[model samples]
Target chain A: MSRTIAVVAAGAMGAAVGARLAARGARVVTSLDGRSEASIVRARAAGMIGVGDAELAGAEIFLSIVPPDKAVGLATRMAAAIAAARTRPVYVDLNAVSPATAREVGAIVAAAGATFVDGGIFGAPPQREGKGPAFHLCGPVGDCAAILAGHGLDAKVLEGGVGAASALKMAYAGITKGLTALGAGMILAATRHGVGGALLDELGASQPELLARLAKGIPDMLPKAYRWVPEMREIAATIGEDRPESAVYTAMAEFYAAVAADHAGEERETALLMRFFAGRG
Target chain B: MSRTIAVVAAGAMGAAVGARLAARGARVVTSLDGRSEASIVRARAAGMIGVGDAELAGAEIFLSIVPPDKAVGLATRMAAAIAAARTRPVYVDLNAVSPATAREVGAIVAAAGATFVDGGIFGAPPQREGKGPAFHLCGPVGDCAAILAGHGLDAKVLEGGVGAASALKMAYAGITKGLTALGAGMILAATRHGVGGALLDELGASQPELLARLAKGIPDMLPKAYRWVPEMREIAATIGEDRPESAVYTAMAEFYAAVAADHAGEERETALLMRFFAGRG
Candidate 1:
């Protein structure tokens, strides 16, 4: 008997994950009520079955994969549907968020009489050929990893109850994405001061690996700058408002917001960054 | 002919550099004015000759190697002494400061009828048996590099004028030190949340290089955190007041200030960081 799983709003990551589960003999159902045509096409191509929001609660597992800002709203929606259904599925939140936000969602799921599993995904989306991303599960995961692994997903259960996975996620992304923002900012400032070449030369002679990481990261970050805005805010929240390190994430939020605006507008700054890494990369 | 170079108020870097010059047969002079006993001992051990403030102006080259906060004060004092002297030696501002600050020092030296060279140091202090730090010089640095190289220093001339070298220094330090602060903050936050062990495990599996860097950098940064406070501020100023990236340096300044305070006060936070990297390092 193929167990049914509800993967919400077929975005890039959601659709890819849905495809992987579907390919491994699982019935993947998704609610695409307000999704775009591109999302609809992705869903169909990924072999996901589209159904109404209420029908989504009938599945054995509900995977909430959405933007950081949308995590709460999706949880609220799923709670209502799960409360009305006879068989409530386990709700798994896999969005990149702070630990505090994870606990807030956990509370909502508990109120709906559904088992909640806190999860965070590391690495890129699953591909047809390559190593798949790891799904770090926390809280009362029970047999969640076994179920996820049965569907060809890489799932690892971490110690501690809720927020462990999110904390790891926040810390990891804080370093990686935080570095990208810092590199882009300083490189632009150096270029503005006409010592950009010298800075690069110094970095090559000193920290070559860091320079190489920036070359690859800054270019890769261009298209995804918009998505990182709220995510950085989430990281700030994870670090707590009382700490000085929290301010770094807040500043990074403002930086990504500016980059997103620049990427959407004339792309002047974006072009400068692309050119900086063009020959070097 | 052996050049008489005045290296002011011999601190660690100043004393080491003075020793290198003295060993290469240059006459190294310094002022003992209000320095601590430790500084006096270091200066004497490094073969530097103690002289009065007015006598320092008689040297062929004046190297201002002090803390970032003391750069302007030293330059002002040098300008006065240069104005009263018969022969105005070339004044090199070698402190970590913003481009604007460098230009300000340049103007002050020029008004006193002394040639000014804007310079910044990269790498650690020169040792007896290892690679020496590079001295980057800008402005009208005529035979300054040749003179410094003759005394066993690695002197490189940069293009443009007064602010060029300072700009390079600011950009380089901004990245290296900025990353260290970000790592320390996030690791502490994770530890506070009880997910620190998992965070390290994940980092070891994913970003092993960054983990290695933090393990070394955090411990090394303990004692030097006090010196980095003003340097981080200079980096913030170098990025200009209007940019979002400037905020990062401001936040980093606060972070280092806190670390310095913590290190001075209770051994609580400092011990936590030390233990975090103890066996892993």
Candidate 2:
């Protein structure tokens, strides 16, 4: 059975995942009204049909893939179109937002008369990696995951209501990204003290695998740092402000913010980091 | 020719490393004047000769292997004795302290007419593991490393001035212990939000090794959480409070402090973590 699927915004993950569905004979429609030329090109290349915002509600399934900061805004933007449709689509939010934010989005979508699935995507884009990332879904998932899995996506239903998937996502990312920030912060501090080389040397001798991971992960993080700021804050929110550990994510947000600024500015700290991580200044 | 080496206040690491040195024919001396009975017993079992504080300066080499909080106070206490001795021993401060703190200790030792070597130990004690940890040294080391190396300890010299070794230690511990705190924080948060099992499931599927590390580390961290408080603070001091990342160590300190309290109190959080990590609620 061919399903009418609307993948909004046509970003990297969206376009890639949409291509998989389209290739598997699903009619993947996307709204590219305000997206960049690059995004339009990606959507077109991925065999997705472009549609107006109002037409998005006509699809049987709606997948929202956007940045953490934009997750709420996107849900609110599509609420009116979804409410006016004859049959409300199963709307899935697959952004890297906290459980709290997921619940908030779920409420907005449910109020608009759609069955909202709280979701989180793990791993890289399928098109680029040649392997699809897992799509974890919660909250009255029904046949939505099966539908997506039938179209070549690795969609799985997690046990719990709305916010379960996001909680897992927040916990997972908090460790991975938090470690990266800790590594970068300590390495930079070591460099400032003129012992960066020694730190790297000791790590190479002692924790070689961890050193290699930081080497690879830190550079890969530079471009994506701007997006990570809100995601870190989301993790902080997931942990809640009352907890002492919440401050870790807040610091990570601030650290990423600094790294983003460093990357955008003269690239002084970025170059130092690149030199340390990638052996290039 | 065997050298006389003084290893102060025999804690776990001190007694083990002292045992290794003692076994290898270096005369290991320690001051048990104010140490716990357990410490004194360990020192004696390690074959370390107990000497009065006044006689500690008479050894050819003095190794300070106390906690980070006690490093400076020990040095200050021993300064007058070192100054009054006929021939001052080469003093080594091997505690986990900030570079700033290391330099401060260096100044105090140098003022007492002893050649001050900043040092840091990596790895577990030799007696427990049957292998020695690396002893990284800086500042006019001057046969201090060679003396330890000759006695079966892996003593290596780092390049730079007084603070190099401490900087490396601070950086390394910051990453290792900091990651442990971050993992514990997120897992506890997930458990609080009723998604801990889901988080562990996802981690097992994606990051098995990291999950295993947390399972082992968070349990191991409980007993040592009290000691890590000062070490984390030293790392925060090393990073400098002006930097955004410094807050990470502060948060880690606070998190560990809370965990320590939890471990001491009703053990609610501790039991939850143990159930998640060790399957023993």
Candidate 3:
């Protein structure tokens, strides 16, 4: 039997996940309003169908991928939608929000007599045709593993209820992305001194492996950093409830957001950042 | 014939270097006035002979290892001593001073017709017997390699003249010691936020190797960082001449000096810094 998968507030990642499921012959329905034109175009390009509230009345699985700041509000609206539905769908709050928010969303879905699963995506949306990144899912969904596996989505179930998945995401992003920022800063400082070459030579001499990794890693990641800023903020806010010290990522989000905003006016900011990372600026 | 080695302004490192040569059977003479009691005791324990200007007249090698602030003054005094010596000696300036100051010392030695070698010690003085660290030397003196080899010191002769050795030292220290300061700040911030445990757990889970190195490195180095602050300042001054942007290290020196000052009165600062590094603060 075909399963109905409803993706709320469909954006790049939401569209990607929906398209991947739809391609596998599942009924993938995405909420159409309150999204950017780019998001709508991306959803259409990814083969996800935009549906009204009436068309989403029979969804068997509800996957919420709205912005983290709007996670609770979306959950409230989705709870009302599910209440009016002919059948209650299993609610999976996949938004990058704190455990407190997730728990509130869980309560909303539970009050509507629907099952809740907490899910967090760990990588970028699948860009090429027919490829998907890791989608880590956790909670007490009776058939989450089988359902996700059947559709070829890599899903892992962790023990700590609503927050563990977000915690893992926050921690991983903090190190990988945080080091990227540090590497960029150092490279810029070196270039400004006109001793970038000398610094790299010394780094190669002393810490060859790390220097090589940093050289390769920094430049390659700069182009995509702008897209990750908001996601990082979402993860930071979600995990910060339990791990308040992760506020560094909140600062990092601001740092990357500034770059992203500047990128909107002059895409050259990313280029400049990359140049600095390569020790050429 | 055995060569005589005279160390001017014998402080901790100067006394150690002189004593190391003496231990290897070189005739070592060190000036003792205005030195700390601990330094004098260390020199006595290491079998270095305390000598006046007349007694240093016959030495074949003169090493200047005074503080950075005293380098020029000591260089002038050593120039007078070298002029009065019966035979010209190879003069090595190993003080942490700007490249310009090093050149000035070089001029002083040249005025006395003595060969000048600019050198920088890369590591701490030997805490135990017969375990001195490496020293990098470069200058007009082509016989520096032979001189150091004869005295059983691990000295590498780099290519550039008076400033290259100091440049290399500054660049290397900038990364290693700069990272040390950064890690110190991050760990302190983490502990202050009451999520030190979580940060440690995350670091262990994500970057075990780096965290392990930081754990071992920070605590062992913090107590000794006070001594390195002035050396860092000297290196900054040297590198900042050709590269005025190396002022970062001067700032770092001030930061380390502040940390040292804070730790001097309160045992808690050192203990807290160590705990933060070990991820248990």
Best candidate, lDDT? 2
For residues A47-122, could you state the per-residue lDDT of candidate 3 as single tens digits? 7788886566468888888766677887777777677778888888876655566788889878977788877775
- Residue clash pairs of candidate 1: none
Candidate 3: regions farther than 4 A off: A1-281, B8-16, B53-58, B65-73, B95-101, B104-114, B123-133, B231-251, B277-279
True contacts kept of each: 0.67, 0.84, 0.03
* Global Cα RMSD, each model: 2.2, 1.8, 7.8
The local distance difference test score of model 2 is 0.89
lDDT per residue (tens digit) for residues B1-281 in model 3: 66788887667777778777887788888877777798789788877888887567558877777766677787777777778877978778776666667788889878977888887666667554654666767777677667777787877676567765555555556556665654554565444434456556556754676677668767766776786688667655654434322444555576677667767767665777777665565
Q: Candidate 2 - CAPRI tier?
A: high
Model 2: pairs clashing at backbone N, Cα or C within 3 Å: none
Can you write out model 1's per-residue Cα lDDT over B143-232, one digit (the tens) per residue?
998999888999999997899999999888888888998888888877877778877887888788888989888888988898889999
Cα lDDT tens digits, model 2, B100-144, are: 999988899899999999999987788544557789999998888
Model 1: what TM-score for its first chain?
0.95
Q: Pick the candidate with the highest DockQ.
A: 2
Q: Which one is best on TM-score?
A: 2
Q: Interface Cα RMSD for all candidates?
A: 0.9, 0.9, 7.5
| lDDT (tens digit, per residue) of candidate 2 on A99-150 | 8899899899899999999999987788733557889999999999999999
